[model samples]
Target: MFDSIKLRKQHGYQAIRDIRTATVKAPFRGFPRLDGEKCDLSCLACTAVCPTGAIATEPLRIDLGRCTFCGECERGCGTGAIQFSSAHSLASTDRNDLIIQSGQTPESFRETAIQSRREIHRLFGRSLKLRQVSAAGCNGCEMELNAANNVNFDMGRFGIEFVASPRHADGIVITGPISRNMAPALKDAYLSISEPRIVVAVGTCAISGGIFADSAQLDRSFLDEVPVDLYIPGCPPHPLTIIGGLLDFRRHK
Candidate 1:
């Protein structure tokens, strides 16, 4: 007992005290704030460099659901018109909310990001069990989702966790583009979960097929067939974004 106590004290508090208001440091790109006024109409440098067609010119906008947060758009643009901030709390239940326009702040994006459903709060505010489906993911998002349950994040403490089977889940968290081969399995998993179940799309690939949207092997029909309860955008969304998104989605107040 003394040895255990000594070890515990040595490590101190490892997890973030608060997920909602915590600040993420440099290198991890979160929100893309676009400056449309500075854009040179002739130059499509940002658009050209984007792998997923996530950038739009004329009235510049970025689709977060399609974005990999690759930093390519910011780096390739010579006009200093784009920047990716370290504000990782970007997640929304509405697909249109992910389409960020120029001059939009994280605060503004967050204000209407989630208009939580009363039924959702009633059913899952206190506890949420999710079955994760990788679909055809590269596993980057899967790894981060795993980290959300680790000692540092401790998502399970709030009663949000991933289960081994869809039979035990209240919802399904999907992490990849719905590939042709994985479509049936994905549908099966969602069906296995009881009613009042949600569908959460995590990462750019799952939400908009990432760079693989045009791929003939992908069958993203599942997204069209089912309504997604939440969309957490990133190539592989940060664990904070994942946990924070879920929390915000279930908050009634």
Candidate 2:
């Protein structure tokens, strides 16, 4: 028991005291800030180096859903057209809203980010149990999702957590591009869960196939079969970003 107390002091209170308003202090690039005036149509430098084609020039919009948050565009652009910020609350209910247009700051996105899915709130009632499907991912996003449930994030305190079985879950959290091999298994997992279920596309791969959209090995039929309730945009979204989205989706905020 004495060892436990010492461990507690050494670790301190790791979880964010207030997940809703907590700001990330690290050199993490959570959101991209776009400047249309600085964007040069002739150069097209940003688009050329973008691995996932997340950036488009006509209206100067960066789709967060496809973004890996690698900061490649910021480095290649000389006009300061794109700069990434530490603002991490980048989840949304609508897929279209993930597209960040020029002159759109993190603050601007926050205004519409989580529109409070009232019906979901009524269905879940401030608690959720999810079954996560790796779907042949690189494991970066999978590691981050595990981190979301750790002592530091402590998402369970809010009554949100992952379950071992789909039968025991309120929904399924999908990561990675759904490979052709995993398609049938992914469908089976979803079918195991009860109705009034939620589907969350938690990373760039699951949302828009990330860097593998053109790859022939992916079969993303499950995405078309059901509507995604929340879209968390990041290579692997921050733990705060994930938990906060779940809370906002359930209208806990």
Q: Which candidate leads the pack in TM-score? A: 1
lDDT comparing candidate 1 with the true structure: 0.91
Q: Per-residue lDDT for 1-253 in model 1, tens only?
A: 9999999899998988886677889877998888999999789999899999999998999999998888999999988889898988889999999999999988888889988989999999899999999989999999999999998999999999889999999999998887899999999999999998999999999999998889999998988899998999988899999988999999998
lDDT of each: 0.91, 0.89
Superposed on all Cα atoms, model 2 deviates from the true structure by an RMSD in Å of 1.6
Over 4 Å off, model 1 = 1-9
Lowest-scoring 10 consecutive residues by lDDT in candidate 2? 117-126
Candidate 2 vs. true structure, TM-score: 0.95
Residue 189 displacement in candidate 2 (angstroms): 0.5
